[model samples]
Target: MSLLDVHRSIVVIIDLQGKLMDMIYRPNLVISSTIRLMKLADLFEVPVVITEQYPKGLGSTHPQVLSVYEKLTTKKFYMEKDSFGCCEDQFYSILKNARPDTNKQQIIIAGIEAHVCVMQTVIELQENGYEAHVCWECVSGRGEEYRDHALQRMNQKGAIITNHESVGFEWARDKNHPKFKEMSRLFREGQITS
Candidate 1:
């Protein structure tokens, strides 16, 4: 309902695991967009939550995505889970509790298998009273129809159907924020033309 406050937002990158990554439609777009979103998170100093779904079977989060989190000192949380919806994972407590200083409520979502894991997670995040902003380009299914319908369903359920650029601009807010210059620079670099 409001702009994404840097203090109240968290980037949640879900289940971009190895074996499933290539199976998704527009895998490269999903990866690149998600990576750019992560960079925006770092620039804005927003926290990020990265989840790996049954890494033993899904084959772990992709090395490039995982490496971004590893290299950044930006606030982050990591969890490995068997649950399709991250909210169902026993290890995940509360999204707002991710940091002691802020009660984060908007979840910027990115990840794979949009029809299954991503869809379930977005719906549940809504049920739990969090704003689930699905970055369209950062999510994919093995088929385009599945991904599109999943997004449609989630939008119908009141999830904010968004993209990485919208999220970045919303977070940056205005040209006056301390990180606005860097935020613009990130998006300017090889950004996909919408």
Candidate 2:
């Protein structure tokens, strides 16, 4: 796959909701990485689509992500769904309504339960002909094994497994890009060093 072009990409934040989020392994890392991804999306004018899986039961999205999203003035797409895979009719309609431009075919994914929702979404994204790139640090499952296996499965199924920093740099493309400095700052600060 080619480096992500900011103008040709979209970030999809999936099912990072309440209690389920709390149970995910290293939830803090996931949250911080996802926040950085959101900021990068905002900086590059990349559209973001956030989904909640039955929020009435799982509760709402984690406040940190919600806060960053709320502050963005760019066109945003938010949907609440019961489907584990976000490729449902409703999501398709929202994506369509967003008027997904021809170049905006690359989808960057981040969220919880990598073995399920994230994996399913990535598979479906590929089926729909969109290149899927999963931000490794931004997705987690309740168990390390689950997360690893999910990523392996995704890679086997044609999804590119990558990190947030790689995605940001790929989007920026060069130091000469207007937002490179801020993107670099975000890359440094957003990393979780054990």
Candidate 3:
């Protein structure tokens, strides 16, 4: 499938909560990438789903990231899931409801504790017939080692590993396209500049 085919894809932001965010290494980077991803989703009119893993115990999603969602004009499905992999009943229901009736079977995912929630969800998505692609730099754990290991394991399990910019460009596909100029400007001048 094409990168810009994200219009048919869903963007899942998994478990990027308050308590977890505090413990993650490079939380700022993940948060920033998430915001960028969300912005791109809005620009492209892609569906977005966000999960908070037991928000009461873990606190809410980080304030900064949460604020971005509030500003989005696009439809967003928000859920509090106790399951690590968001492929559980509630989340899957949301996914089914939000899914565009098209050939885009891809799911672009990013979130915290890569080895746990992110890894599990990506695997489940693949098993369930969705093309799962994880944005590497947009996911992290409490330590660099843990993050590295999770990424390695996810790659081994057949997830398409990529970075945030790569995802954005893939969605844009062509420099001369209308959305291309806007997407490029947002990437080059927005908070996600790498």
Give the lowest summed-lDDT range of ten residues in model 3.
1-10
Best by lDDT: 2
Model 2 misplacement above 4 A: 190-194
Which parts of model 3 have CA positions greater than 4 angstroms off?
A: 1-4, 190-194
lDDT string for model 1 (99-151, tens) is 56655488899998899989999998888778889999999989999999999
Clashes of each: 0, 0, 1
Q: Each model's TM-score?
A: 0.93, 0.94, 0.93
RMSD of each: 1.9, 1.5, 1.8
| CA lDDT, candidate 3, residue 63 | 87
Return the clash pairs for model 3, or none. Answer: 4-171
Residue 72 Cα positional deviation in candidate 3, in Å, after optimal superposition: 1.0
Q: 28-75, model 2: which lDDT tens digit per residue?
A: 889988888888888888889999999988999999899999997667
How far is 125's C-alpha from truth in model 2 (Å)?
Answer: 1.0
Runs of candidate 1 with Cα error greater than 4 angstroms are 89-94, 101-104, 191-194
Clashing pairs in 2: none
What overall lDDT goes with each candidate model?
Answer: 0.85, 0.87, 0.83
TM-score of 2: 0.94
Which is better, 1 or 3, measured by lDDT?
Answer: 1
